[model samples]
Target: MASTPAPTSRRRTGATRERQSTHEGFLVHKSGRWIKISAALAAALILLYIFVPLPPHHFGSSWLGYTLGTVGALLILWLTALGMRKRAITPGRWSLKAWTSAHVWLGVLLIVIGTLHSGFAFGWNVHTLAWALMMIVIVSGIFGVTAYATLPRALSANRYDAEGAITEKQMVEALRSLDRQLHDAAQPLDRECAILVDHSLEQDPFTGSIINRLTGRYPGDATREAASELRRLRAHRPRVADDPLDKVDALLTRKEAMLARLRRHLRIKGWLQAWLYVHVPMTFALIAALSAHIVSVFFYW
Candidate 1:
């Protein structure tokens, strides 16, 4: 008699679904409550801007403009506080996750507040310069949010193989393993092929500029060139299964694939980090300009 199959398959599927459902990103934490709150705040500010009476030609010196400017300045300071908050790990209601969510949404709100405060009056002056710098900081922050949401999964997938997930250290070790095998395999080869193998071995996989890290383009990739050259050299010769050239060719091919994966990982990492370079510096510039704008206003008043 055929026995009924157990419910293990159904249980495993349910567990997987549960895990996926529970995974909460800071951007969407608590159904994006911070984002909703920020939206409401921005809407209220926009409506206030529309209804508030003002002179026919208004500048930031106007009452409503001063209010928005105050709000925007406070928001900028609070947003900057995240840089410090991130270093202090904590949990619960005021968790790092909650702070980050607030930071992102409130930062977005600054665009509306700042633009309204400017009264659409842009010039080559300190006030307009502050607004422009604020825009740069916001745009860079948006890029960072996008990268954080997406790149980790790509990085994880890049590190996985038939054997399972590997760490950054493992990736380096894999490359070293291939290099050692190639060295041993090519020991019996002639001068020309030996030089090719040595070239591949001598090249550092991690040696590249920021552009190379971003683009994943290695025009002088020694392993790739050596692999192609060895394959070409073997093409005209008789097929010999035990040839050291054949082994070296296989090892070199594997090394090329591994290096490609490692470079791709680096490129993804570079994207994840590149935004901070702009965000942090521009934030400081915005603060300086903001200080100048405030001083100029009160000084001239």
Candidate 2:
């Protein structure tokens, strides 16, 4: 029989292989130690640039500014690439979270870099428009960041998951369940009850624009039609006075809550979706403007 490996030897080999296989994250400063070192270096560099006066302005006087601008451009391009990627978007590390952090801090650094680039000079020109556009892009980016960073947490916290993310089928099922409950609870006198419940769940998602959502103005032809149907039904079958009606009333309350929850969830997601409509196209416009500014500054100057 062949000799078997010792347990300790096998364990040692496995541990060594495991350590070797693990990949460090981007920039390769995998541990907290590297984070501390990187932070110290960044702080030191900033302090050096701030306090240590340099020689007279020259060809590369704004070298650091150019570097920062290039970096920012690369980041914007990278974000665009991310958009192009059809795979699922994720939150942290090499993902939107990491991109966002880069965006925030690098943007903060841009203030330093861009100002130094101008040598604090400003005039009415294409260059000024580019700068203005940069500021606008940055502001919009800030808004995008703020909107996404907080709203997801808010959406999670505010949403009721007892039913756990109701869908169209679920809404229909809930209505059916209510209908079943209503059979015993609803009086023969209660008018057109099922129709009202159906209308409530059947509200279409794409009913109006962002403004309509903001104002809760869901009213439209469909809504008006539904309301009219409900009214016509209710008039013919007079209100029922029965104790079992209490259970029907309670079922109505539950269904309403579920419908409301679903609508609110869809609405909030819609808001998040709408922000990109402004943020992305503006970024493209900014890139065009920035390119024009760069060319004019170098060629015309």
Candidate 3:
């Protein structure tokens, strides 16, 4: 009788699959029903603006203009309510996700409503100022949506390494470990090489301003400078198997690479947050302008 074949072990792919997230973000919520609804609403408003008869040389004082203005004003109030609605978490049909989805799509719809309400009559007045503020808010919101959709993946990819995903704390710990290793490795080197290592170690990876964070440009990166200088110093020197400078150079190169990754992460994160700095403040300005527009309209009437 033939001997029984050995049992084959199955390769577990669960860890690989578990690493990826399948979460549907708020923008794509409910198969983008809100997007469809908003598109339809915008289309209808445009048709009304085009087909509906208005008096010759008419302005925003027409009945259709008043209707669109009313709708636009109500939409603005509802859009603003999201700031408060987001604070309270609720489940089911009217969930925060649903509200966010509606907020985004309906906010886009405001562009059509607002433009038609303006009757294409732009001038340097409170009305035009209100429209300008609304456009600013809408554009900032568009940036926010794009950032939310794309930056998260970039952020996750930046955090991953051959050792898999790392936490913020782990990034700092790894840098510290590399620094300690560089310090130990530089001990046997001459004073010049030791100074290079010291310079690399003393540099802070997170010392850049907001502009540096956004641009990912650290002009004074000591680790990078040290690595370049060590490479040049080693160019003419004969290779030694146990050269202390070689180890320090290699460690400095690694520290520089790690700092680059951190800076890239910061850049992506800065973009993710920078829009809010404009969106929130501009929203308040839009509200104030809207209030003035409304008051001026009634005050003159």
Candidate 4:
């Protein structure tokens, strides 16, 4: 007679299945399965390169070198396929998450494969240029990984205030509303004070270069200058109840606060997107260089 499994064992199996089915972030998808595979493969290749007896001078033309070169070229083609995969939405086994996990880890694996293929011979040639471009793409990818990991939290924290979370559209609207209030409040102010308020009101909210977005520094920010000037002038004047300048000053201060948050949002958003500009174009360039490298190697070299 056979014994039946206990309920607890059955429950454990069910729990394991449930956990496995639950999706995780691509980096840790399948409990870092792709990472482990890449690491193991890289280690194996390095060991083979070091221990497999072959003359150093002839290594690039050796069987192992040809194999590594073929694998690397094919891997690059597959990695590029990720861009196409992103267009379709699907689930299970070869899901976008799994594809992305493979893309990142296999992309990393190319470093070892490409270096071993070159057999450490470097020069000012198409081969070296292709390798350099690959390196740039990898480094840019690393930057993208870091940005995606950290920036979302910073964006979330920046958006939340006493009231609740604010959207990008809300942030812009808040600035516009404050500007309207400032315009009305400045009606009774003397020309000098009114001019200060106008400097802020007439200024465009979105006027800044890429450098300004990245660094979050706007030296010529009219709002900041207006607020500072209003404070300096107010410090010298006599205090009065409900003075128009006081209201205008308050509005300016509020507008300044809003602008700070809005710029922070823009800065964080820029950082998140900046890497793709380099990574994508450089990838195409790498492919072009890689094709030239292959042609030279097989037909010309």
Candidate 5:
């Protein structure tokens, strides 16, 4: 005779299952605590901006304006430290996940803080330049956040097939295997057909412009063109069993399918990386403009 499990054991097993099923993305880390804090900070700044009296033209001279400017500057510096934090992984209250959540929400808070600090002043000066650059950095950050949150699922889906998930190395090996098979299969093909197959084999799968990678459009794809031309030539030939062109055509079609999956993987991976090229450079530029703005203000005052 066997004994049944206790009720407490059953409840514990269910709880463990529940925990395993719940996934917490960076956006919703700690149940969106950072989002709530950011909202509160922005609201406080807005209230201060409304209640505190200042000269109509006061942009940086007033105490409140200077205070807001200081806060915004410190926030920008802290947000920029996230890149450094990524290299050193740690756990606890200030984990990387919490840092990222705060980075995103607090970076958004800058729009209100910077605007209030400027006092609605705009002109053809370094002050305005800093503001514009800040806007660009924030916008690019938003795009990056969106990409990270969404595109990862797409990348994962791209790697999966009926059998299992394919790794990058496996993708490369699969293509090489297909190319070798193609090489052997093309031997009995006619001279013109052989040339086309050779072109497909020799062409590099990874060579493409950034635009082509991001857009997943390779207009001059050698493999695709070769497959199309072979099919066209095959159309005019009478149907025959074990024809060499038939084997070659089928191999080309498989290679095309593999190439498409590889390119899609590259496209998603490219999108994941492309935003940093704009965001990182613009961040440094913003810092430079901010330094100039600060210097000119104190120099004149």
Candidate 6:
């Protein structure tokens, strides 16, 4: 008979528990079958809506094919709502991933069924406008899905820390180190202005909303302003031949490069974020358009 030894350390036991929990959380579990079933049902419904004939189905005046068309349109609206509801929350069992998959495929279904529901009828009217809006909504949703799939993970990775929190603290600490070096070097460079310029760059001339970050259209005339200060300070002073000061400038340049990279990483993070402005607004507009279309169908019929 043999008995296995247990984990000898509390840390090891805790780590094992954490891994087990994460593995359970990430398991395929029940979603695969449910997703397949939903996809199949949605596909079948789309096909039936497009091809099936219905009579005594008054759109507004004639309760014939229009009746079945209304059903399909409502179904799409319902599916789209599921996506909207899931937007503000984390992806759980009907997670963002599932909602996105459903939104994309169902949107494709909308194109086929919505067009059929219209019976090839389109004119320059509010009715047609709504259909146009739905198309825009669906396209923007694809952008949303793409952004979520790609950017967030990268942003977390660029933090260079595994806990998944991207902190501005790293940038602050880097700048502080650069400032200390710049201060010690400035006195030797023949004036303090050179050091001040270095300080200002570390301060990052940019700030505020997502657009400003994405555009890199930083505020203030820092470059010209700093150069002006340098000109004033250097006017009559003999050029310093200190190798140590030159080395300081070189070190500052390296710090500048690091700051630029942080900004670039922030800019990429901004692009991933800003598209949602278009995606969300367009979705709201689609609901409005689809609603108008539904109303018009009943009103005209």
Sort the candidates on lDDT, descending order.
5, 4, 1, 3, 6, 2
lDDT of 3 by residue, 13-41 (tens): 54444343235668878778898999999
Residue 264 in model 2: lDDT = 64
- The weakest ten consecutive residues by lDDT in model 1 span 52-61
Look at candidate 6 and tell me the lDDT of residue 158.
68
lDDT tens per residue, model 4, 112-213: 999999999999989899999999998899899889989999999999999999999999999999988888888898999889889889999889899999
In terms of lDDT, model 2 sits at: 0.57
Compared with the true structure, all predictions reach lDDT values of: 0.90, 0.57, 0.87, 0.91, 0.92, 0.61
Better of 1 and 5 by TM-score: 5
Superposed Cα deviation of residue 37, candidate 3 (Å): 1.4
Q: Give the Cα RMSD of candidate 1.
A: 4.8
Give the runs in model 5 whose Cα sits over 4 Å from its true position: 1-22
TM-scores for every candidate against the unseen true structure: 0.89, 0.56, 0.88, 0.92, 0.92, 0.63
**In candidate 3, which residue pairs get closer than 3 Å at backbone N, Cα or C atoms, i.e. clash?**
none
Worst 10 residues of 6 by lDDT: 25-34
From the highest TM-score down, the ranking of the candidates is 4, 5, 1, 3, 6, 2
- State the lDDT of candidate 2 residue by residue for 141-222, as single tens digits: 6676676767776567545465555454565576566556655454442455645544544555446677766444565533
Return the top candidate by lDDT: 5
**Which lDDT tens digits does candidate 5 get at residues 154-252?**
999999999999998899999999999999999998899999999999999998899999999999899999999999998999988889998898999
Worst 10 residues of 4 by lDDT: 17-26
> Which of candidates 3 and 5 reaches a greater lDDT?
5
